[model samples]
Target: MELLLAVIPPLLCYVIFSLCKIGFQKRDQRCYMLSYQCHKAPEDQKLDTGSCADIVTRNKNLGIEEYRFLLRTMVSSGIGEETYCPKNVIDGREESATHMDAVSEMDGIIFQTLDKLFAKTGVSPSEIDIIVSSVSLFSPAPSLTARLINRYRMREDVKAFNLSGMGCSASVVAIDLVKQLFRTCKNSLAIVVSTESMGPNWYSGKDKSMMLSNILFRTGGCSMLLTNNRALKNKALLELTCSVRTHIGSIDEAYRSCIQVEDDLGHKGFRLTRDLPKAGAKALAMNLRVLLPKVLPPLEMLRYVITYYRNKIMKRSSPKGAGPGLDLKSGIDHFCVHPGGRAIIDEVGKSLALSDYDLEPARMALYRFGNTSSGGLWYVLGYMEAKKRLKKGDKILMISLGAGFKCNNCVWKVLKDLDDTNVWQDCIDHYPPSTIGNPFSAKFDWINDESMDFARREDYLPLLKKHSR
Candidate 1:
């Protein structure tokens, strides 16, 4: 048949592309699953401490500016509202709080979100065979993963480990690790948590060169479940087609572009000295080099072959960063870019050629919650769920960039209708409607006709001019 003949060549190209993913050097800069963590809190706020006495105790100790800024950002940002603070129960001093307590305050939110994720995945905590958590800050006795295993009191055979100091890219890098584990085993379940302890990591010093990272990053977390069994794959939550990682050399400038340290003013934090947009583009180019075989059909490649060559010769840099360098937009039905900052999201949107509608969730997440770092994607995903934009077989592409000059991504296809109208949804209704600058409205008073002035803000896409750097 004519249709059959037409499909064969494209299918063949996909098969070849799939094969190319088998081997790749893992590259991750710390985002979606990779980046930073939250602020520093005292003993009372550790996951083990669940007393109002504790949050209040610690809240009082927090600097006024810090508390005011965080409250404004997290409260107004449209990320889901939930057990804002989940703490561990130690000796019942605080009976039962949230997992927020036991999470060592490395930014307690990541794990709390994961608990909801567990419920969404429909996999019992007991059903999980492995627990792998990555957070750049915090160490807990009976690690956070162990607490989950204990809370479920599942089988004693569950494998658990905690990893930190790895950049934000660890989630996919961690998933890749789990993939190898499941490949060697059968019917095993792995839960990977990627979060950043950003609350404590915010840079607060006179080092103007390093403070940029702080301005961009916010607080958030993301979790993923991976399984190798074909049986499980049939009923899996999200089917990951594959993943790719690529890295540029991690030089001093790149390293210091986003470095963690205690500032001269005694404010210890992480900073960014990057023109990060450029770095992100470079990594994307490299990933595409390896990704060509998997998604591009030979016929599609034929169309691209000319286009690719034409760009190589015909144009260099336009006023807007334009003329075909990587079309991240078409490759994904939805995107959950890190709510790193307003500028970051704007740059990402412009570079990828995404429309305002396509970037609504990311901007809303930033406006709503500040940046929850590793958890940022989940908040954006929460927005998508509120809109019910996800359907089975819908493919979502996520990309994160961070410290090691790293970049990594995952492509997920929904296997079923995710019951997203959960706690986060209830929380979102509390905020003002978010739009282009105030996509999620500002909680405080706004000047008259502010939204009109705000419309001009939409044109603030920084990476619009190619070769501007």
Candidate 2:
């Protein structure tokens, strides 16, 4: 009887404690991006047409005509002079590419950024519940995720995922994975490390299609920390609302559009077919059809429904092309469209009916950092925050396209003022440059273009006023 009395009192105390913990704690399982940073390579590695030609000359497979094609592509690429490459390539040294070079690039980017993020958020590595690392070109023996785990000395039991070959959409895909994991494991923190290494992937071949990668891709990376802990609400910059992913790889043309291949001479390069932009558009449309209705306000959805029926009725009288436009801008305030290339950005902007101001961050990111693969979207977001255009309660949509002919979108609601103490600090002042484009350039006179009518232009101002409250 004495032993039963002792056990009953302790059991009652434990029940009371459990009840208090569950009742008082906030159980918002939504993930938040606490912080992120993008890597900046050295200045000497920045390549122009002449510098690219110098490297092309080293490859016996390329000729003068191919060199001229690269130069022409560069003219329309929207890439400026600040993007970077490896040290040996910039120094004109003939060092054989090694796994260490790619590992070094990943180390420099992943460790530095993760370090800063940890410091900014005051979250230790041991506290991290999951770590996801993604890279396209190089997947070594140990894996980048394993490297991060060892470097940070994270807990042995912490889950780690290493993603390879996912291309530029890999990071967002990682976020999707994290979201699902957080739904199951509450009060968890995850780190997403995004990077691409050009050391081994550099094309030494003459295939014009493959050579496009050399002209556009640059050295850049981003590391972001995500958490499901409600205690981190104040520190988080944005809250994840929804994520959508679409892959058109089942289509033969789309599957072949962006792929890594070996030329006849045995030189490896990533091949980009002409159908890439169309494939990207299709994938984006597919993803948005599923994603938009979930996030769009009721009025916006009704308007789209009305437009759809009106278009169906008009199809009898007009060309069958007068269908309902996506009208995404009506629901989203800021956009971080992947600056994959000038063509991709232009295609996405036109498809979404985005304004010049809406695309400024993407254009500026392309100009400043070139296409850093999955990392480019973060740079675009950084550009917007650096410009002080983002505000609390604003909604942001980030879109990325990858080699699988994949389109992924993540919708986020701003939680707090942006934390820009790292990546944007050095060059943010020079961005959205004073002289952007000429009268004939695509950037100019876009605001008044008839194509933008689908954005519901007249309602933009009123919508902003409504959101401001």
Question: Evaluated with TM-score, which candidate comes out highest?
Answer: 2
Residue-wise C-alpha lDDT for candidate 1, range 1-469, written one tens digit per residue: 9999999999999988776654321211111121112222233422211221223223222333342343344333333322122223222323233344435544355546556666655667777787788776666677767766766686898888787765666666677667666554556777777776543343434454444443344445666666655555555556666678887746555555555676666656565555556776677667657764565456566666777777679874344766244454445588878776766777777767777788887877765555655556667777777677888777787766665677777776677665554434544564436433321123222212334343332232221111112
What lDDT would each prediction earn against the true structure?
0.56, 0.79
Q: After TM-score superposition, what is the CA distance of residue 442 in candidate 1 from its true location, in Å? A: 10
List TM-scores for all candidates, in order.
0.66, 0.84
| Candidate 2 residue spans exceeding 4 A from truth | 1-28, 48-50, 93-95, 316-326, 419-421, 434-469
Error of 2 at 58 (Å): 2.5
- Expressed as tens digits, the lDDT of each residue in 1-469 for candidate 2 is 9999989999999999998877654355578888887787666777654455456556655444554465557667888756777665666642367667667767877887888778877889999999888887778888778888888888989998888899989989999999988867878989998888876677767899998998788888898889988887887899999899999999999999999998888878899999988898899889988989988888889886887789788883433333336566667899899988888888888777788898888998888788999888998998888888778988899999998889999899998766463566887777767864322123222434455455552443333223222
Candidate 1 stretches greater than 4 Å from native = 1-122, 198-219, 311-319, 323-331, 417-419, 427-469
Query: Clashes in model 2: which pairs?
Result: none
lDDT of 2 at 362: 93
